[model samples]
Target: MTAVSQMKCACDSCLCIVSPNEQAVQKDGKYYCSDACASGHSNGEGCGHTGCDCN
Candidate 1:
């Protein structure tokens, strides 16, 4: 059994091309499996906050 959450990370990245979003879930919206994958957007790390939260 898994948690009642569905997160997914279907974004663009060099790694994503060969490797699927190894860290992504679908919790109402797409999400990364870990913070690293979504860390480049927090605190304005060029995450494109205006687009999707990288953090």
Candidate 2:
């Protein structure tokens, strides 16, 4: 699927804000400020859906 560049946080992690130009190509359309945050969630490091990064 295409990347989502302008969506708000609806996931468990809502602390970090989504940048205007930043985007994440997640299966569930999850949005994060950076890859590190997304990766963290996937590894169960931070707050997010299960397997969040791989979405």
Candidate 3:
């Protein structure tokens, strides 16, 4: 079987694809691209990646 490497960020509004073996943030059994996404953007912050307006 092929090992999973990359997947979309867990945040509903996020458009980023992250590598599970890299810096992807793991939260509640889901993978996110940033801490902001992991926390559901409660502080109204974006993921800091350009072109992604998730907050």
Candidate with best TM-score: 3
lDDT-better candidate, 1 vs 3:
3
Put down candidate 1 lDDT per residue, 1-55, tens digits, no spaces. Answer: 8553433344343132111344353233546444444554345443332345444
- Candidate 3 residue lDDT tens string, 1-55: 9988999999999999999899999999999999999999999999999999998
Q: For every model shown, what is its TM-score relative to the native structure?
A: 0.24, 0.32, 0.95
Please write out the lDDT profile of model 2 over residues 1-55, one tens digit for every residue.
9764566554454554454454553434565555545564565455444444422
Q: Model 3 TM-score?
A: 0.95
Best by lDDT: 3
lDDT of model number 1:
0.39
Going through the candidates in the order shown, the clash numbers are 12, 1, 0
The RMSD (Cα, Å) of candidate 2 is: 8.3
Provide the clash count, candidate 1: 12
On a 0 to 100 scale, what is the lDDT of residue 23 in model 2? 52
Give the Å shift of residue 51 in candidate 1: 27
